[model samples]
Target: MITEKAPGKLYIAGEYAVVENGFPAILVALNQFVYCSIEPSTNGTGKIVSHQYQNNAVQWHRQGDQMIVDQRDNPFSYILSAIQVTEEYARTLNKPLDVYDLHIDSELDSASGKKYGLGSSAAVTVATVKALCQFYHLPVNNDRIFKLAAIAHFAVQGNGSLGDVAASVYGGWIAYHSFDRQWLAEQRKFLDLTTLLNLPWPNLKIETLTAPANLALVIGWTGKPASTSQLVDKISLFKARQQAQYQEFLNASRQCIQRMINGFHAGSLEMIQTEIRYNRSLLQELARRSGVQIETPVLKQLCQIAEQFGGAAKTSGAGGGDCGIVAIDAQADLQSMINQWTAENIEHLPLAVHFMNNVHRYTIKLK
Candidate 1:
């Protein structure tokens, strides 16, 4: 059996503008990941099985030069895209695609809980590229992996920043700015910052080597599921009309993120607290100006409560409605806040700070 696991990412900065002008973005590969295992069949057909998600098996068959498919859930899209991309690349070197049965599972989605603004689809794409690399044994690196993932993401989700994509692939906190300069093909150049100010205390460790212990956080659920695709499209459509204002808000966001980073490093709770408010104010202003109302009153309430502790609070993912992440320091009123949230059916997730600068590749072989 052939098995492989690949990382997922969270965007620390450049959420919207990373696509605007290849602006800088920061992200980190999370401890959570997606894994795929494949086994070749003597028969000339393939099947995709899911161990974790509540989905049916996807079946496929080879017809002359094409691999025909029948899928139930959408997760299989990644595996197929990976196969097609790899197969196309291999063909340039006089190679044929690997014909095999595959299974995929991920830890990103809960059956129904804690939704963040990060795109789950993008994570699937990242995992797909990783699994495809293992299946084909391609000599692909982090940048190349993200380039391919961008293609897959484009195929389905249209255009996105690839901020989280870079982080998911690389791991750790990153300060990324996208520069659309191409070597062979156009790709993003991420000039990442290792030291970010606003990152939470206990930076969740995915590989055990990057344990930024001074961070702490809690997640608040708005009990609503929001899709990044639609929100992204709406923003793009409105970009022209709101270009000037958007740029200004983004500039403010960058400033807030930088200030947060400074506060995080200075070991000053006051600084951290102040920066969080600043960041939250900018986000609120963006939503108000755009008339997007991404932040609900309840969400704002959660942030206020989290702020009562040593950290600042804000929403996590896209804004229409989803979960939010709170950034806190070591010694605060965190436990009491958790107690109150527990009574409200809100759960506290282990906090994390984005901690990666590059997309990463891992390999394992089966005999």
Candidate 2:
């Protein structure tokens, strides 16, 4: 048996901007993770067990040149896609592929199963791809696994920035530029799976970054779940309608992200704090112009609370609701922030920084 675990992620900055022309974004992998357990089976069949899904288990097998699952509900579609894509890549190299049973689990949510807007899908995709490669003895590295997971994720969701996938594949803080999904979509028309895998994903940039030495990470969950797609669509329509204003917003966002990056590298707490404030303001202004509520009232309240405690805060990810990230130093009272959040009915997540220590892939174990 082989097991792979990958961490979920929180977007520190650059949410909507990364979707357009691959602007940079910052993300941090949470200690919370999604796990995949794989074991070879002799029956020439595949099975997936995921308690997270309504339909917990789905059995599948290959038929001539296709994979067919037993259930139409298809709860583990992301895992299935990972398997099929990996199998296709293996066949291209004339390598043998074996059937396996995969069990999925996650530690990125509430006991009641309420997701704190962690990138669960991306984590699962990365873990599944890693598990398949390890089980089959594929000579794939972290970069290839990241690309494969991105492909599988796009195939399922149709569109995404893939920041979460990057964070999962390469744990720790990262500055990322999205791969061109528009180009990928067009290429899918003529390119075969193997050819697609070989195509250089130009313009996608990912660099491991360090957080400021004095910066403290605080995550607060807004009880309400958010649909990232819906929020992104709202912002996209706003961009289409208000191109000039959106352009200005994008430019500002780019600068702010850069400033934050510089701040992280220089270990400048002031630069980090200033950029966080600027980013929060810019996001709110963009929301006003877009006619979309990117930050809900509770999220605004979260910022206010953080600010009152001398910390800078902003919504993470596509956030109409979900988590808000706060950055502070010794000057800010951590306990006071938590107490205020509790008073306001916000749940302070007991999550901290996770550094990847120059490694790109998850910890894989064989049993």
Candidate 3:
């Protein structure tokens, strides 16, 4: 059996803006991970099991070079899509296939089966693709795995900025500009699987970023889960209706993300905090203009609490709910911050960067 694991992701900045053309996002891979284990199936069939989704396992089979799982409504659609897309990639390389039983486990909390918005879906997709590639002895690396996992994610979700997927593949702080999804989606319909897999994705930009050494990153869960895809769709609609305003917001978001990136590299605490405040303000403004509350009351409370603790805090993703993160000086009283957050009923997730720059490969072991 071959096992592979990928870290969950947190968005440091750039949420809605990254879906727009050329806007950059900052993301970090969390220490928490989604793990996948693959081994040949003795029953001449395929099965997938997830510890987090106990009843979702289903048998699958290859039908005319396409593997079809038994249930279309299975909760583990990301894993199934990853396997299907990887199989198509193998066909591109003329590599033979095998039926395997895949087991998935995750450290990202889904207390009572509700997601924590830690990018679990993307993590599992990345981990599964890597494990399958390893199990089949196919040549793969971080970049290739990223592309394959991205395609699978897109196939399953219809749309995503892929910042989380990149974080999972690259496993560090990243300055990410999204691919032109409008162009890519159109291309996906007509392009052959082999050619599509090899596309340079010229519009995408992903670079490893270094944190300012004295910066302390902390995450606090609002105890409310969010649907990122739903939020993205709402923003997309708002953008379609308010083109001029959306363009202006997009520009501000781009500038804020750039400043944040620079702060990380230069170790400028002032610059980092200032830009984070700007980012939070822009998100609030965007929410106002879009007729949505991206920053819910509890999230605002978290930000206020972080500011009280001498840091800047903001919601991490599509923030109707889920976690918010704080960036502060390393010497700040972290436990005090956590204590306050707890009193306010926010769960502090003790997540930090688990890997440094350019360390993108998944942890693998043979059993």
Q: Whose TM-score is greatest here?
A: 3
In terms of lDDT, the poorest run of 10 residues in model 1 is: 192-201
Judge candidate 2 against the unseen true structure and give its global Cα lDDT, from 0 to 1. 0.82
Best by lDDT: 3
State the lDDT of candidate 3 residue by residue for 278-299, as single tens digits.
Answer: 9999999999999887998989
Model 3 clash pairs are none
TM-score of each: 0.75, 0.89, 0.91
The regions of model 2 sitting more than 4 angstroms off are: 42-45, 55-75, 193-195, 357-367
Q: Candidate 3: where are CA atoms >4 Å away? A: 55-75, 356-367
Regarding TM-score, does 1 or 3 come out ahead?
Answer: 3
Q: Residue by residue across 1-367, what tens digits does model 1's lDDT show? A: 7776656555433456556543444455556667777777669788877665445345567999999663312555655666665566555555557567877777666655333444555666677677767667766766566666655555544455556565666566555544332321222123211111112112111121222355564566666666665667666666779888887877776676566556545655566557656666766777777666667766776777776765677765555666666656666677898776666655555535444344242321100
- Give the CA lDDT, 0 to 100, for residue 158 in model 3: 69
* TM-score, prediction 2: 0.89
lDDT of 1 at 55: 50
What's the C-alpha lDDT at position 174 in model 3?
Answer: 82
